[model samples]
Target: MAHAKVKRLPVVDHVGMLQGIVSRADLLKVFLRDDDEIAEEVRREVVAYLFAAPVSAVRVDVRNGVVTLTGHARDTSLVPMAARLVRAVEGVVDVEFELMRSEGPAEPMAAPANGGENLSRA
Candidate 1:
């Protein structure tokens, strides 16, 4: 409705049956949410559920319904998917990413014979 600048929309059921009508006011009422609420939803729903990662893995910061995501993830492919899911959340104004690819696991590097710290770069 807001996208088309229309005031009302026809509500439909699963079978495409007209259930009722939805006005712009109704949509606003449903979509309006606090910034913290939006951030929690994004963290719980998008990052934790969709990505199957702990909430700590992704840093979610929301201001005025705009979300900014940072931190690391093992699967970088899910970054775009996370963004889409965040956008789908109600009351989210926009999504931004500063996420870094996570190093899957730590490995011990071969030490020099001098018994010193490894100074060689990968």
Candidate 2:
């Protein structure tokens, strides 16, 4: 848009037919996302997938565009991975963690059917 010096851009379909128009303000609106909405995505996408219940419990808090994760994690070392995922979330300007390392070795949610005990982290 800066190179073209256009405040508004037109959207077109496959055949080059006009669909809609997008403005600079429209593209910038993503940063205006609500805090609660951002928190929910962190919980669903990052927390639920990385830290499951019973073994781990994570709390998500969002203010402005920063996200803070608190509570316990089976492997606190995964904080870097979690931060990367959380930063990928839209409207999340930054990510922070206050996770405590969960005691004991990380294990799978369910025992394998093979009848052999194995250690796993997901």
Top-TM-score candidate index: 2
**lDDT digits (tens) for residues 3-120 of candidate 2:** 8899999999999999999999998887999999999877766776667554247889999989999888777777887788788778888988888977877645432233222112
Candidate 1: C-alpha RMSD after superposition: 14.1
| Error in Å for residue 64 of model 1 | 1.4
Which runs in model 2 stand beyond 4 Å of their true positions?
Answer: 1-22, 109-122
Candidate 1 lDDT by residue in tens digits, 1-122: 66788988898999999999989788676357888898876766666654454458778999888899988777777677677777877788789999887776522232233332211111
Local distance difference test scores for all models: 0.71, 0.76
Clashes by residue pair, model 1: none
RMSD of each: 14.1, 8.4
Those runs of model 1 whose alpha carbons end farther than 4 Å from true positions after fitting are 1-19, 50-54, 105-122
